[model samples]
Target chain A: MMAGSALRRLMAEYKQLTVNPPEGIIAGPINEDNFFEWEAFITGPEGTCFEGGIFPAKLVFPPDYPLSPPKMQFLCEMFHPNIYADGRVCISILHAPGDDPMGYETSAERWSPVQSVEKILLSVVSMLAEPNDESGANVDAAKMWREDREQFNKIAEEIVRKTLDLPPP
Target chain B: MADDASSSSGITGNTVENSINQDELIMKQQREIEKEISETIPLVGEIEELQTLEKEYNEDPIYLLKVKDLSSKYKSIRRTRPDGNCFFRAFSYAYLERLLTDKQEYDKFYEIAKNSKDILVALGFSQFTVEDFYETFMEVIQRVGEHAGSTPDLIETVRMELHDKFNKQGYSDYIVVYLRLITSGQLQTDQEFYQNFIEGPRTVTEFCRQEVEPMYKESDHIHIIALSNALKVCVRVKYMDRGEGSQVIAHDFPEGSTPLVHLLYRPGHYDILYA
Candidate 1:
């Protein structure tokens, strides 16, 4: 019963997106019958190093959604300190709601169902601008970030080049 | 000995006859119950069919004649032109009302709304009302486009644009027309966009029917009216207590409140002294 309501809301959200779409984001259900799983394509932010990158991601919402946040993971390879080897995004907004065990985030910083894909993308853009080095999803990248700033930038630049299919910057 | 054997044989034959008689009686009773059950189906179907036909026929010329008679009784009542602003303010509630009661009435009204020229002029002023809604909606889109990067900025921009759009007197007239569809239950929120815009007014009516009907059950009308009236008071209090931000401007909400409306209202939100 709870799942039914969440499904309905998810469908409504899907419908809203299809009608009055936000820029730089294209998302819909994987299948007409399945609103629980959505496939989203996001264009890399304009005027950023990651420009021209067309990243595909998946959003899987739990049955008790709106009360719980969806899990969003990049299907495409993304090499960054904040992105894990498994392609899971590490951001404050996507974290489980409430106090963080490692004392990193406040309750307000965590994910809420009210957080739409638009908000999440915006947060990711902000994250790209400023990475949280303290809690690194990729330890090697974090080490590079802390130890050798130039080398870290080089590696990020290389990844961005590969993403855009251009020569290394 | 012979006489005793004969009498026993005779008694066995009588016992078999008695058993057959009992079986026939049980079979007869079952048939009567079966017959009654069989007869009820056609009778019930006929009754339901008649009721349906009766309703459809009521929309005929005879029914219109009865309506004419009723109207003649109240003929002295002048068809006064409603204040444009008042009409705009009342649209949502009235639209919601019509949406719940009869879907067809809203459909008929929407059919008349297909011509943008007719909708614009026939509604309140000259043939320009539909054009006005289009412009206002476009303005909202343009405002949203301006704040492309941030979520907070997007919300703020949209709200500001809506505030401007609604403040204009032309929009007040449009709101009434929009509400007329809602109250008539012709428009549903879930209808496809092509149907809503391209098809006649019925689509808008359907949108109201689908979107807002579920929010308030028929039994809850009195409570909803009370709540709406109380909301006015809340807006007033917010204006007086908070100063600058609490004006009940169209489409603008209290700052930083979530985009979604709080469907569940507490008792205090509606506590008002009604005469």
Candidate 2:
């Protein structure tokens, strides 16, 4: 019964995303038959260390989609403060209130019924541009980001190049 | 020294893993408790005599006194699930149920509810999602409004229909969700005024996103005030707490309007009261 409404909302969001696709972001169901599992490709924000890279992530929505936030994880290799070593994205917007495993700030935007796929993807893009080291999912990456700017940028650039199948510079 | 460093790193990894596991375990237990509550209690229980409340507080003299005072003013109570959306759920249920007999009020509310979608959309809400919730909310309202002015027997049947629909998780939750959106829209529209009520540096919109909009986030006086103001429906909440009073304190939302809906508020939950 819950799936019925979740499917309808997912389809509506899918149509909205297609008709007016956000810049550098494309997302839809992986299989048209399954609205719960979506594949999203987000272009790294320009002028950031992740620039020029296209990152693909999977969003597995719960049966109560929109009520509960979807679980998002990158399919490719990712090295960022907020991205777990296994590529799971850990951001505030993907968690409901009081379900904070990362102890996100209270002011951070959270998952509400009004929040949509477009909003989550946009937040992800901004998260890539500026990682919040305070709630770091990758401690090593966060420490490097704080103490070794050059080394962090080099690793980010390598990941970016690897995303494009280019030889590491 | 090298062996010590490697062992220390391993222990750190183990600690992280253990903490993650503990968090997951706590979350799982919470879900289990929620599931038990859902299975045992209806989303909105049937109306019961106000005296039933006394049974729960048998050992406590203060609560018994307060319940006695409440029973004097209210004859019955209809409980809503203790889920965070109880305020919205109980308010909407009580209001709509009251509207069943009052055709005039139902018509007026119908117009307001009908036009609420546009208000939300104009306030920068995504039309696609808001419309879905609005449609479901309207459908339920229309269903309940159908038997207005009918015979007593028919009205009873319609009441049963209302009860059945409320029991269904889909319809009940959608109603809560739509009311929440309306509350959110109202807060954003009157951001300057509501901003003072919010603690910390969070803006009105930020508070709405974090507190008002999310499901399972408990409501406070701010929420009650915003929702009551938005719907133009007066609400009187009788706070039943362990404060040093024999009588339950009554505070009306918006401070001074005739209350069309009465609710019993206990710390974190709200239930409907019928006089």
Candidate 3:
């Protein structure tokens, strides 16, 4: 019964996303048969180290959809402060308030029914542009980002190239 | 020594995996606790005599006194699940139950509820999502209103139906979500006025996103005030606490209006009260 409502909302959101695809994000259900799983491709923000790359991610929504936030993970390798080594994204908007695995600031945007798939992807695009170092899912990447900008940019560029199936420069 | 050893090992290979597993474990336990509560308690329980509260507070003189004072004014209580959505659930259930008998108030509420979707959309809420909740909310309201002007027996039957719908998880939570949306809409529409109530640097919209919109987030004074003003309904909450008083303090939402809904506030929970 709960999954029924979740599926309906997912279909509606899928249609909305398709009709007015956000500027840098394209997403849809992985299979027409199962709306629970989605695949999205996000373009790296321009003027950033991740520029010119197409990053793929997977969103696995629970039976309670909008009520609870979906689990988002990058399909390709990511070396961001907020993206875990295993590719799971750790932004605040992906978590409900007080769930606090990462201890996000109180003012950070949280996962609520009003937030849509489009909003999550836009936050991801901005996350790629400016990584928040405080809640580092990838400690090594966060360390590099804080202590050595040049090295961090080099790694980000490699990751960007990797997403595009290009050889490291 | 055991803690030290575990901490040292935690720093070694696969720390990320270990940490993630720990977080998952904590979340799993939280879910289990919630499940236990849900199994033991109904979303909204059947009405019970106010004396039932006395048994729970019999040993404590302060609470016992407060319960006695509460009973003087209110005869019965309808308890809601103490899950964080209790305030919204209890308030809506009590108000709709009242609407079952009051056709005039029902009409007023029905019109406000019917027009709420457009207000939310105008406030930048997505029509797609708001539409589903609005539809369900209207259906429930319409069902309860169907027997509003009928015989006493028919009204009783509709009242049972209202109880059944409130106990159902999907319908009940959807109503709560819709009310939360309306509350959010109210806060945003009067941002300048609401902004003064918020602490720190967060704007009205930010406060709504974090505190008001999320499911399972508890409601506060600001929430009650906004919701009451938005719906044009007044709520009188009788605050019962251990603080230095035998009398349960009654505070109306808008301070001066007659309260159509009476609720008993006990620390973190709210329950419907009947006079």
For the predicted complex of model 3, DockQ is: 0.55
| Top candidate (DockQ) | 2
Tell me each candidate's RMSD, in Å, in order: 26.7, 2.8, 2.7
Question: What is each candidate's DockQ, to 2 decimals?
Answer: 0.01, 0.66, 0.55
Give per-candidate clash totals: 26, 0, 0
lDDT of 2 by residue, B184-238 (tens): 9999999999998999888898889889898888999999999998888999999
Candidate 1 off by > 4 Å: A99-103, A165-169, B1-275
lDDT of each: 0.45, 0.89, 0.91
User: Which model is ahead, 1 or 2, in terms of TM-score?
Assistant: 2
Name the TM-score of candidate 3: 0.94
Off by over 4 Å in 2: B1-39
Classify candidate 2 by CAPRI docking class. medium
Across B1-275, the per-residue lDDT of candidate 3 in tens digits comes to 88857776846746665676688778868976875876688899999999999999879999999999998898999999987899999999999988888999999998999999999999889898897788889999999889886789999999999999999888898999999999999999999999999998889998998899998889999999999999999999999988997999999999888899999999988999999
Question: What tier of docking accuracy does candidate 1 attain?
Answer: incorrect
Model 2, first chain, TM-score of 0.98
